[model samples]
Target chain A: MIGTFVVARRELSGLFMAPFTWIVLLVVLFINGLLFSSFLYQTQGNVTATLSESMTGPSFWLWMIFLPALLSMRLVAEESRSGTLEYLLTAPVSDAAVVLGKFLAATGFLALLWSSSLIYAVTLDYAGGPPDWPAVIGTWFGTILVSGLFVSIGMLASTSTSTPLLAAFLSMVSCLMWIAIPFLAANIMAYLVPLLTSTAAEQAVLAERMGSVVASMDALRHFSRSFQMGVLDTAEIVFFLTWISFFLFLTARSIEARRWRG
Target chain B: MIEVANLTRRYGALLAVDDLSFEIGRGEVVGFLGPNGAGKTTTIRILAGYLAATKAGRLVVAGHDVQRDSMGVRRSIGYLPESVPLYPELRVEEMMRFQGRLHRMDRQAMRVRIPEVLERVGVQDRGKQLVGTLSRGLKQRVGLAVALLPDPEVLILDEPTSGLDPIQRGEVRDLIHSLADDRTVLLSSHILAEVESVAPRVIILHEGQKVADGKPAELAASLGGGGHVAVEVMGAASAEDMSSLIGSLPGVESVATGERVGIHQSFEVRGEGDLREDIGALAMTQSWALRELSWQRPTLEQLFTRLVTGRGLDELAMPVASGPGAAPSSKPEAGPAGLSADAPVLASGLELSQGPTGPSALPLGTPGNAGSKIIYSLNPFDRGASRDLSKPVSVDAPPEAPAEGLPDGASEETES
Candidate 1:
């Protein structure tokens, strides 16, 4: 355990000192700020009328998608590229601790990026009258949950390839699939006749159920209703945490397999 | 202490290391000597715990099984590869601290140990410089410094003095010698002098097997059939006459002649039995003044070549004088002033060719020449001789060519 902590601390500090971290941070923050400010101006000041309303919507979703690309790029990819992964693996730490340490550090960086948007929250309170505190907090929770999922998925992608650019691309593609496949399935089913859909459903029950569940699970709607309304949902929180764990599990397996192959 | 038994490592179909085994006890400095591609690096890597053996063998480091307790083995051992791997981004001090931390050294120990190692390796001034900014020798010193960080019980270095200047090489050799008071070091090198200087015990590897192992002097004497004897004489007889007399003396197997004047001659006598009494008697009978006569030991070079070439030293000794039938009566008139009587004879039954003369009248081996043809079939050393001495003879004379057309340039070059 002590060895794990030592490795983790050194690795975390290494990332902080690396130029790639600052470049990614500056680029993501600039792009996110530009998009959010543009959206607010386009909405003619109504977008900033309340912190909850401003935080919940496509604007926040854009932040979720773009932030993952930035923070997850170097998680596993840089270590492999630099041959430091071998050094780390040969250390006295367990594989789980290595994956978790890196995962937590990347998540922490993403959280810091997300926290910077608090300036906008403060601006809403000052200019648009007292902001909606419950909604603002709920939206922040959803963003964090989504970021956690992204961090895990990014780690998996990093472990899968030695190239950082390739890892980032794979992570983004997988995340997009997770977000888009459900919507695509729901739209396709909406146009399908009952007789045709029923025949396909018999062949693949799980696929049909997945499509239906994805279609009905309105992430933004749930965010506004439960989280924005100050109503915490056990199922939603559990869902996010489960995804995080599943990807982390995959990352652990990848790291273990490297020892044998390498 | 380290013990490796039947350790074998294979990459695909190539056997990098083949059932190699050796042991180093506490406070012993051992040299691993071998030619390139002879598996020295492979053996070092396995001992360092950097690579696992394909076919596992019993490998113990400081009482810990290498495979089962690699961390313990790592903690107890220090390794420096042929090309040291270092982080260029970090300063020397930073890199040392990081390595110490990785080895689980506490803050207090690291704070004290880093500077001590840096100073021991004589790189204290370069601690603030990035590793990439240092010279090759300094980087090598830093590599040694890092290896010493954990105060490991065993140190394994591969080609430690390679690429260093003479002074730096001496410094590193001295440092390695100084460390003998506490730690066991296993160093590998192709340079015979380096091994002779640092290690008293040598293990010579050839084609993935231990060909020779023992103290340097013992191995040299065993391989050469016996020790060497250096005889310097001040006599009225020419060096050629002295060498011939020495060659014919009892117990003298062979004689190699050096520079000579009217009464000054130097030569090397090699044989299994002592020849000092017989040589002294011959000098008295002939009334030849003997200036110096001392027994000389065989060198590491002779030992190494004998093992690698699988040839006996007696067979390889230069033929100072031909058999009785071929011996010139009263010794043929000596060549130029500086030429030794036992030096290579230029004239032979083989025909000589002509070309632009460089240094001598020797013919560079032509495709159809009998000498070249005979050389190729005789021995490997003969082939090396042809490569070093073969040159096209000049039909047109150049004014700069040395008189007497003797093969003296190469010999003088080596002496200088």
Candidate 2:
């Protein structure tokens, strides 16, 4: 565990010290900050009424997933590409430590990217708008949970090959698919419900039941909608924790396999 | 400190390291020598406990089984890979701390040890400098520093002096010489002369198997290869008379008449042992004033030429007869194993016409010529206005394990 933290510290230092890391952070923050301020302007003096509405939009979710994927894509791939992975894996630390170290660093940056919206939240509160603290906290939770999954997925992609660009491309495709899964499943169910049922009433009931089941399987359902409205569900929390561990465990396995393959 | 048996690593059908076995005791600095594709790096990586040999190979490093307790083995070994890969974002001091932490050194110990290693490698001033901003030579020093941070029981360096300029190379050699006294070091390089200069015991790999493993001098002598001694005599005697006069000695194999510059008559003497004393005596008896007499140690090029003539491992130079279970080819081209029959090389030490045996103007002396030069300690720490490093108990050092208590014959295991 100590070795894992040490590796995390080294990797985190590497990430923050590089110009690219900082440049990417600045650009994403600037872009997100711009969008937040525009939402604030749109809220006008009735900021309390629409704070949750503004935070739950498409741009927030998209940037949360996109930025983390971009950042985490380099986590293992750059180390392998630069030949430092050889040094890293050869250290007395376990393969899991190396994997977790990189994951920790990428996730730290992703969290920073997601939480930068606190500036807008603080501004709204200072201007006499209700703090909407519950919504604010919930959105923060949902954004991080979403970014956490994307970052871990990106990390897994990073380990599959030594090419950073390819890793980034893979992680992007996977994260886009994460969003598209729910929509795809719901659409397929929508198209099939009418065909599978005879009466119109039966079709409506079957569609509702199938839609809820498929929607529950979609990892993002509760977090993006209900959680952003300040209603955190235990099942959504469990889902986030479970899948993050799953991806992180896969990342560790990928790293351990390098010894056998190389 | 290290032992291996029947180590084999195959990249697909190509055998990179084939059934190699050797032993290295503590306080010994051995050279892992070979041309490209001879699996020198692979062997070092395995020894360092980073890479695993294919199953059924037994490797013990620092008293721990490399396969079973790899982390323990890694903790005891300091490895410098062929190209020193460093984090560009890290400062020299940061990199040291990073390695120290990886080795599980205490933070307080790391604080003190980091400076000590940096000082030892002669880079104390540059600890704050980023690794990327430093030159290759300095980067190598930092790499050496990182390796030394743990004060590991065994050091494995892969081509440590490669790519450095001659002066830098010499400095690194001197540094390695200092470190060999108390700690064990195993360095791998394709250049035989580089190994000859630093390591006393050499394990040469030909086509990923041990072709020769012994002291460089022993291998050279057993192969009928040794250096030459040339004398410049200014006298009335003809070159033919001088040649015959020097050739009368038992050991002098052949004497060649050299340049006739004005009144000076030069003769190149080739033979075994130190013929300098014999030639000087002949010149004294004849009352001929000899201007200069120096010996040129037969370089590894001589060894390669003998191999080229099929005197050594002829199959080593043979091209891969065919793929998979076919005759392994030290290939003359497309990498080493496939084309060795034609080029007979890929050996790097041949470039220097004047190799390690040329002359040492510095107080640093070769293994056999200890008394001839002034006392100089290769140890940078012992530099209190120069001290003799010839003491029985020297500092933790260095390369070239003295040829003693070691197997006289290299383990020759055919490809299995």
Candidate 3:
């Protein structure tokens, strides 16, 4: 565990020295700030009301995917590319510690990026409106959970390959697969099994129940409204936690798999 | 400090390291010498805990099983990989600090130790330089500093002086020698001289197997055929007369003459026992001048080439600056005991191409003919070919350039 922290601290300091990190920071801030000003313009400059919705909307999920993918690509890929993976793993540190340290570093950077949204939270509070502060905080937790799961997937992708570009491509692919595959599977089932749709009477009730069961597996149900409204749902948090573990489990296995080669 | 038994590492269908085993006692410096792809790096990687050995093998580093207690083994060993992977963005001190921390050093200990280690490796002035910007030599020094961090009980360096210049190689060799008083160091290098300078004991690997191990000079002598002796003969009738005089001695293998100057000639007496005293006694009875007598130990390169590829030392001792037959330096190789023991004879007298500084053949090489021959040996007292300036070896131009102009062109190119 201490190894994990040591690696994380060094990795964080390294990120600070990287120009790419600052570039990402500048670009994300510029774009989000533009969006915030546009939100004000759209609301006729009413900053008090549109704060929470603007803070946790589609732009936030965009941050969830692209920003974390960029940060996590280097977590495993750069180390292996630079051959520093040998140095890191051969230290008196376990595979889990190295992987977890890198994952936490990426997550930590994502958290720093997300903290910029707190400026919006403060704006809402300062504007003297009855802001949905609980929803803001709950959705903030949900955002991190979502980001962690995505970054873990990115890190898993990075662990599978030595090239940073391939790692980045794999991370993007993995994130999209995680976010879209379940819904795609359910949609395909709905189309192929027309009988899964409701008709009439008892058979129709069973078909509708089955369809709803499959649809409930869609990721949208958890975060679409309940998380957006700051309902603090345990189910969404658990889903993120489970998926994050699954990605991290695959990542640790990937790291160990490299031990087989030169 | 290190032990291995039946240690084998296989990469799928290929055996990278065979059932190899060797031991190094505490504070010993062992050089791992091998041709490329000879399992030197693979074995070092296994010892350093970078790669795990196959289940059939047993490797214990510093008393910890490599495969079982790798972390404990790693804690005791500092490894410098062949490629010297370093974070380019990090300064030397920063990298050392990070390595120190990774080794579990405390904040206060690291603060005091980083500068000390950086200075020890002679990179203290470059501590603030980014590793990417430093020369290969300085990078190697920093790599050494990193390995020296935490004061590891065992140090594993792979080709520590591989790509550096001779001067840099000397610096690294001196550093490795300094490390020998306390830490057990296992280093691998293709530079034979660098190995000769630091490691008294060497383990030579050929095709993933241990071919030879022992004191380097002993190995060279035992496997390197009979060592040769440099004998300058005077007051003898002819070259054959000198050959017969020495060849009759017990343990005398063959007699090859060097620079046949009239009544006097230098003979390389190849064989076993100390025939010098016997030759001196023969010269005493025969009323000949036995000006110089010295033994030349067979070089490790000869032993290694013979063991690895069944090639003769003369063929393998091709000029370092040029390929075989083409001498790297223009310096004549004859007069003094020839570096290429069989260097081709030139017009009038013979001119020899400078190669490995052969054993001294003194009183024969006169000073005025320094242009014809220059003999350099580790022995400072290597008296020049018998100072008898009477029958001087002709200091002519280089051996005839091949009729084809390309030989001349190659020499000109090398000069430029």
Number of the predicted model whose TM-score against the real structure is largest = 3
Q: Give, for candidate 1 chain A, the lowest lDDT window spanning 10 residues.
A: A47-56
Error of 2 at B332 (Å): 37
Best by DockQ: 3
Which DockQ values do the candidates obtain, in the order shown? 0.25, 0.58, 0.61
lDDT per residue as tens, model 2, B340-382: 2332211111111122222232235445334422354443322
> For each of the candidates, what fraction of the native contacts does it recover?
0.07, 0.61, 0.60
Cα displacement (angstroms), candidate 1, residue B171, comes to: 2.6
Global lDDT scores for all candidate models: 0.69, 0.72, 0.73
Instruction: Say which prediction, candidate 1 or candidate 3, comes out ahead on DockQ.
Output: 3
Q: For candidate 2, what is the TM-score?
A: 0.74
Per-residue CA lDDT of model 2 for A4-74, tens digit only, reads 89998997898888898888878877776776667667877556445555556777667655676678767
Off by over 4 Å in 3: A44-49, A190-220, B230-245, B249-251, B256-268, B273-294, B312-416
Per-residue accuracy of model 1 over A1-262 as CA lDDT, tens digit each: 6665665565566667678778877986786677667766776666434344445556566656656755676766776776556445544455687787777777777777676556677776777545556656666777677788887888899899989888888888877766676577666666654545457556367556756577544454445557666566887788778878999999989876664343
Encode model 3's per-residue lDDT on B39-69: one tens digit a residue. 9988888888777777535688888988889
Name the regions of candidate 1 deviating beyond 4 angstroms.
A46-104, A122-201, A204-262, B224-244, B255-269, B273-416
**Candidate 1's residue-wise lDDT over B1-416, tens digit each?**
88888987776678777888888898999999999988898787667665667765789988888878877777787777777656556789987887787788989999999999999999999989987688988988998888889898888898999989999899999999998779999999999999999999999998888888899988976677666676766554445677788899877787877433322455778776777878888888977667777776667776787788887664454333332111333232222222334433222211122222322333445533333221322322122222222433222211132223346444333221
lDDT of 3 by residue, A184-243 (tens): 766676565556445447555665666676555555556665766768778777877787
Each prediction's TM-score versus the true structure = 0.68, 0.74, 0.79
